[model samples]
Every structure is written in structure tokens, then in C-alpha cells.
Target: MKTFTSPALSGLPGLRHAFFTRDGGVSKGIYAGLNGGIGSNDDPADVAENRRRMAEAMGVDVAHFLTAHQIHSPDVAVATMPWSPEARPRVDAMVTATPGLALGVTTADCGPILFADAKARVIGAAHAGWKGAFTGVLENTINEMEKLGANRADITVAIGPLIRQPSYEVGAEFVARFTEADPAFARFFIPSAREGHAMFDLAGFIRMRLQRAGIVDIDDTGIDTYPDEQLFSYRRTVHRKEPDYGRQIHAIVLAR
Candidate 1:
């Protein structure tokens, strides 16, 4: 099967990003192939080798790849240049004005949003899980990109590999959180099987947030991680009573 990836990375002027699927790596068992999550129980050597392969594919220095601590918070990181791999930054979104530094973020079921403004020569990658989305991580990423000269109108945003609404059954408490965030959000939830559970549209909510930020070139590929066995899924893994799951990486680099 073909691995799922973001098309927004294609044809951009000196920019690169991939929504790497679960293929072409050394991790065995549940981690299987292309398992890039360092946080996962996958072997450190396998994880490092997988990261090296992704960097080589993106045409950047394997040493220059940067990712966050990812607390599911809304904080954003602005990269001045290549960050040391030894320093794990504690932020969800990474915006880079300096070229050639690949900003990487991991997701198993959360939305990995890639941003690029050809005119501004800027790119950003964000890990927006439910909590981060509710707290405005997407908005913060866009705002930080603008600080580096990307106009919202000129920026193109693409959301990659997520558990679609049909596969994402949430509890009433989850539905209530959005309703409390904004009554308009109540509409984003649809009735699901079983009482007190609703189907949440994660990608739709992401596009809505981007549109609200005035970026509407939304490319939602409709890839559902939970149902697709090729890629990993946190929820699906949990539902299957698995011990742990791998995380795919969404990374972007801008050439200076």
C-alpha cells in the first residue's frame, strides 16, 4: 500500500515536508516500518535510523531536524536556525525563518498541519491534538509565521493524516468541552453510536480554525489513521488493548 503524505510539500519553492506513513523503516513488530517516534518504546537505534532516513528524504541535514516536547499545549517555537538535537524544545508548533532547518512534529492520531508561504519564504509545522487545538495552537502557529513575514492570505495550509470523524467516537464530556469553548463548536460534533458519545470531526475543526485565521487553501486528504492499519493510531491501539503505538512524523523545511 502507498504511504500517506502531504501534497502541499510538493512543488513549493525550496520547501519540503512529508506526512510519512508507516513504511520503509527498520522497526519490527507493532512499530513495524518507518516508526519515527523517539518517545515510543521502539528501539532508540531504530528510531534514530528512521529519523535519519526521513531527513535524507527531505534533503536536509539529519542533525538539523528539530521536534518539540509536545505537551499538547498551544505554545509555539520560532527557530532562528538549526537547533541542537540534544535540546528538546518544549513547544507544540515550530516556525522557521531560517532556511534548511526542518521543523518536525509527531502525531499518531492528532492533526499534523504544515504551513508555507512561498512569498514570505517561511514554513511551519504544528502538532494539534484535541487539547492543543482547543487552546489555539493553529492560530498561534499562523500568528508566529506572520511575525517571520508570512501573510495569512499568502500562506497555504495542509492538514495531514488524522483519525476522521467516522472513526473518532468521543464522549459527551469531549463534546461539552467544545461547546464550552464556543457554542459554534457544538455543530462540529455529530451523533454517534451508543448514548453519550459523539463523533468528532478533527480535520473539519482544523480547517475551520485555519479558515477563521483567514487561510482557506485547506487540503484535507481525508486520511483516517484509526481505520488504516498501515499507519499507527493511538486511539485504535488503545481500543485494541495494545501496549504502545508508533508516531508518524510531519516535517517541513524552507530553503533560504
Candidate 2:
């Protein structure tokens, strides 16, 4: 399977992480290539086998590879052990200090952020869509990691693939939501070709938030999922009128 690693997290000791691409899996058609999204409509067996491969790559047992039932909320969960798919927490982010457990987040166009504090042996994975990022999922993930003995300054974050601003145009109300939250947020948007619409810089906004939270060691793969065929994109799928889309799994694990 193809995977991308960030330099900030790659040099860290005692942990493993990957920003998996839409490559190397058994699923066919729309769900092909490492579709680890359990909530997706792909064949259950195919999804399971794909996840097994991801878990193996992370050096964790398949059962220990955990992802939440993401709701695009700012909620965060702390994982102490493996949970069955039926029992996955309904949250946007997860943190764990426990070794042998992989914290994962599934995404198509949303941002997949992997975090680690090697000194504290704490790791986190957050699924940050526009709503989740605006509502504070990134901050919550850092706070949860702090609670697990991670110092914010010591935590290195790696942002994975997501739809870039050029491919992410939004209506007036979407721009209003961010500006209403903070007028300064208006800078994150630029005029789009369509009237009453603007291109939103999701990655830039995410980076701003992390900096505001005092995380200096941050690395972004800077891979835009929308135009990149190697990655899956929800918007791309929608524009094409496809029935369903695949999701790439990005995970981080503290070594045992």
C-alpha cells in the first residue's frame, strides 16, 4: 500500500504513522484502493481486509486499529484499548498514550491530522472537516493529548491529504459562518468565479489554529486530495455524480 509520511513526525522516535493513499486494496470500483472507512457502503469483507492491511503497516493488530464513528463534531475520545466497530466512539478525534493501539481517522476530502509527543508517548488522530475545524476539533485533540501527559510544545503535528482551496468553493453563508465566529477568518477566503461564493482555504485555516494553540512543530504533506487521483475526494465524487466514494485512513501509533 502507498503511504505518505511527514518529516516532523517521521523523525520522532517510538511511534509510527502514515497518510495512506487510495492504493493497494482489494475493493473494486468506487471503493477500490485501501478503503478503510467502516461507515462507507463498500463490501464489509473488503473494508475489513483493507483495514487489516493498514493495521499491519502501523504494526498493530487489526482489532487494535481504531477509528471513531465521526460526526463532524468537535468531540474527542480517549482510547485506552480496542473497541469493536459497533462500539466505536462517536467523535471527531481520538488520543491514546497506550502502546500497541493505533488511533485512526477516515477521510475523503476532510483533513486527516496525525499528532505525536514522543517524549510523553502520546498520539492522536483527528478528522477535521470545515465544520470540525471551525468548531475546534484540532484544539480539542491537542488538549486531550495534553491530558495524557503531552506538552503542547512537544507535540508535533502532521496534516495529511485534503481538498485544497482551489477545489473547495463555498457559498456566502459558509463564509459568513467563519467570519461571524471571528472577523479575522475572512482572510481565509478568496473570491471564486461564481457570484456570492468564495474559495475556502481549509489547510491554511487549520495551520492558523494550530499555531494559535502554541504548536510550533507542524508539517503538512500539502497534498490536495481533490485533483490528486491517488487520493479519494468526497467533492470529486459528488461532482462526478458517483453513488459512493472511498476514504483513506490516516493513523498514528505509539510503538510497544
Candidate 3:
């Protein structure tokens, strides 16, 4: 299957990880390629097989490739072992110190961020959509990692493919939320041609949040998912009036 690896995470020791794309799987149509989203309308067997491929690629067993039912909240789960798909928690992020278990999150246009502190052997994965990020998912994920012995100073984060600012136009109220949170957030929004609408720099805001959280190392792929046909995109699908869109998986694991 086609996948992208973060150079930041690659040099880290005792870790295996990947940000998978929509390619090289048995799925067909819009869900074609390795669609690992268990919540999509795609056939369960197909998603299962796709995730199985991802598991093998990440050097984990099928049962060890874990993900959660994301609720766009600040909730973060700690994984000691993989939960059955039906049993996954309603959380937007996860952290793990356990070896051989892969922690993953699914996304289309939303941000998929992977974190690791090599010395601590702790890894984290977060689904940072505007809601989750605004609600503090990234910070909570790091806090959970600290509970597992990770250090913020030693942590390195890699932001995988996501919808860049140009493709992320938003309503005034949406902009209001951030500006209300902190006046500085206004810098992340640029005025759009449409009155009261603005383009948002989602990836940039995420990077800023990571930095403020005290993480010393950060890598942004700077790949825009909406314009890149190689990656799946929720906003793209909506604009095209597609019935459904598939999600891609971003995962990290502690090597066995």
C-alpha cells in the first residue's frame, strides 16, 4: 500500500510508523485503495483487510493495530493492547508505552499527528480537526504520554497530510471561536473574497499549539490533502457531491 513516513519520526529509535494513503488495497470506487476507516460505509471485510495490510506494514498483528471511534473531543485514551473495533473508545487521541501495539487515528481532511519521544519509548497519535484542536486534544495527548513517562522536551511530532489553509474556508462564527479563545488566533485566518469568510491555516495552528505545549521538535509534511488526489479528503468529496468519502490511517508503534 502507498504510505508516507515522517523524516522526524524515521530517525527515532525503536519505533515503526506510517501515514497511509488511498492506494494498494482490494477496495473499489471512492473507497478504492487502502481505506482503513472502520466507520465508513465501505465493506467491513475490505476495511479489515486494508487495516491488516497496515498492521503488517507497521510490524504489528491485526489485533494489535488499534484505533478509536473519534468524537472530535479532547478525550485521549491510553492503549495497553488493541481493543476490538466495536470496543474502541470515543476519543480523538491516544498514547502508548507498550511495545508491539500500534496506535492509530483516521482522517480525511482533518490533521493526523504522530508523536514520539524515542528515549522514553512512548508514542502518541492524535486526530486534530478544528474542534478537537480547539478543545485541547493535542495537549491532553501529551499529558497522557507524560503519565506514561514521556517528556515534552524530548517529544518530536510529525503532522501528516491535511487540508491546508487555502482549501479550508470557514464561516465567521468559526473564526469567532478561535479569536474568542485567544486574540492571537486571528493571525491564522486570512480574509476570504466572500464577505465574513476566512481561510484557516489548520496545520499552522496545530504546529503553534504543539510548540506552546513545550514540544521541541515538530515536522509538518506541508502536504495538502484536498488538492492531492493521492490522499482522501472530506471537503473535496462534499464539493463534488459524492455520497461518501473514505478515510486514511496514520499510525505509530513501539517496536517489539
Candidate 4:
């Protein structure tokens, strides 16, 4: 399967991660290639097989390849052992210092952020959509990692593919939500051609949140999922009037 890795986390000792694209999998139709989203309408068997591939890539057993039942909330989970799909926690991020358990987050256009503090051997995966980022998922992920003995300054974060500002147009309320939270956030929005609409910079906002959380080592894949054919995008699926959409899984694991 085709995947992207962040340079910041690539050379970290005992770390393995991948920002998987919708490139390789057995599913056909709209769920084609590496649709790891259990909540998606894709065939269950195909999803299992796809996750198995991801687990193998991360050098862990399929059972140990973990992802939460994301709710776009700031909730974070600490994974010490694998949980069944039916039992996945309702959270947007996960952190772990335990070796062999791969933490993953499923997303289409939402940001997938992988974090690692090599010195502490702690790793985290966060699903940072606008709501999650605005509500503190990124900071919560770091806090959870800190609880596991990670130092925020020693942590390195890699932001994976997501909807970039150029392709992410939002209504007035969306812009209002950010600016209302902090007037300074207005800078992340640019007027779109459509009236009462603006392009939102999700990546930039994510980076800002990381920096604000005191994380200095960061990297971004800079891939826009909306226009990238290799990646699945929820907004693209909606624009095309497709009945359902697939999701890509971005994951991290400590191999020690």
C-alpha cells in the first residue's frame, strides 16, 4: 500500500508510522483501496483485510492495530492492549508507551496527526477535524502523552493529509465559531468567491495548536485529500453525490 511518513518522526528510534492512502486494498467501487474505516459502509471483510495490511505494515499483529470510534471530541485514550472493534473507545486521539500496539485514527478529509517522543517511547495518534482542533484534542493528546512520561518539548508531531484551505470552504457560522473562540483566529480564514463563505486553513490551525501546546518538532505531509485522487475525501464524496465514502487510516507504533 502507498503511504507517507513524516521526516520528523522517521529517524526516531523504534518508531514506525504511515499516512496510508487509498491505494492498495481489495475493496472495489467507492471503497477502493485501504478503506480502514470500520464505521464506513464498505464490506466488513474488506475492512478487516485492509486493517490487516496496515497492521503488517506497522509490524504488529492485526489485533494490535488499534483505532478509536472517533466522535470529533477532545477525548483521548491510552492504549495498553488491543480492543475489539465493537469495544473501541469513543475518542478522537490515543497515546501509548507500550510496544507493539499500533494506534491509528481514521479520516478522509480530516487531519491525521501522529506524535512521538522517542526519548520517552510514547506515541500518539489524533483525528483533528475542525471541531476536534478547536476543542483541544491536540493538546489533550499531548497531555495524555505527558501522563505517560513524555515531555512536550521532546515530542515530535507529523500532520498527515487532510482538506487544505484552498479546497475547504466554510459558511459564515464556521468562521464565526473560530473567531468567536479567539478573535485572532480570523487570520486563518480568507474570503472565498462565494458570498458569506471563506476558505478555512485546517492545517495551519492544527500547527498553531501544536505550537501553542509547546510542541516544537513538527512536520506536515501537506497533502490535500480533497483533490488527491489517491486519498479518500468525505467532501469529495458528497460533491460527487456518492452514496458512501471510504476512510484512510494513519497510524503509529513503537517497535521496541
lDDT of 1 by residue, 128-204 (tens): 98888888999999999999999998888888989899998999998988998789998788998789999999888
> What is the C-alpha lDDT profile of model 3 across 1-256, one tens digit per residue?
6789999999999998899988877788988888988889999899999989989998989999999999999999999877888899999999999999999899999999999999999999999999998889999999999999999999999999999999999999999999998999999999998998999999999999999999879998899999999899999999999999899999999998
RMSDs, each prediction?
1.5, 0.7, 0.8, 0.6
Provide the clashing-pair count of each candidate structure. Answer: 0, 0, 0, 0
Model 1, CA-based lDDT: 0.87
Poorest lDDT segment (10 consecutive residues) of candidate 2? 31-40
Q: Which residue ranges in model 3 land beyond 4 Å of their true spot? A: none
Model 3 steric clash pairs:
none
Q: How far in Å is the alpha carbon of 4 misplaced in model 4?
A: 0.7
* TM-score, structure 2 vs. true: 0.99
lDDT, candidates in the order shown? 0.87, 0.93, 0.93, 0.95
Model 3 TM-score, all chains together = 0.98
Give me candidate 4's TM-score against the actual structure. 0.99
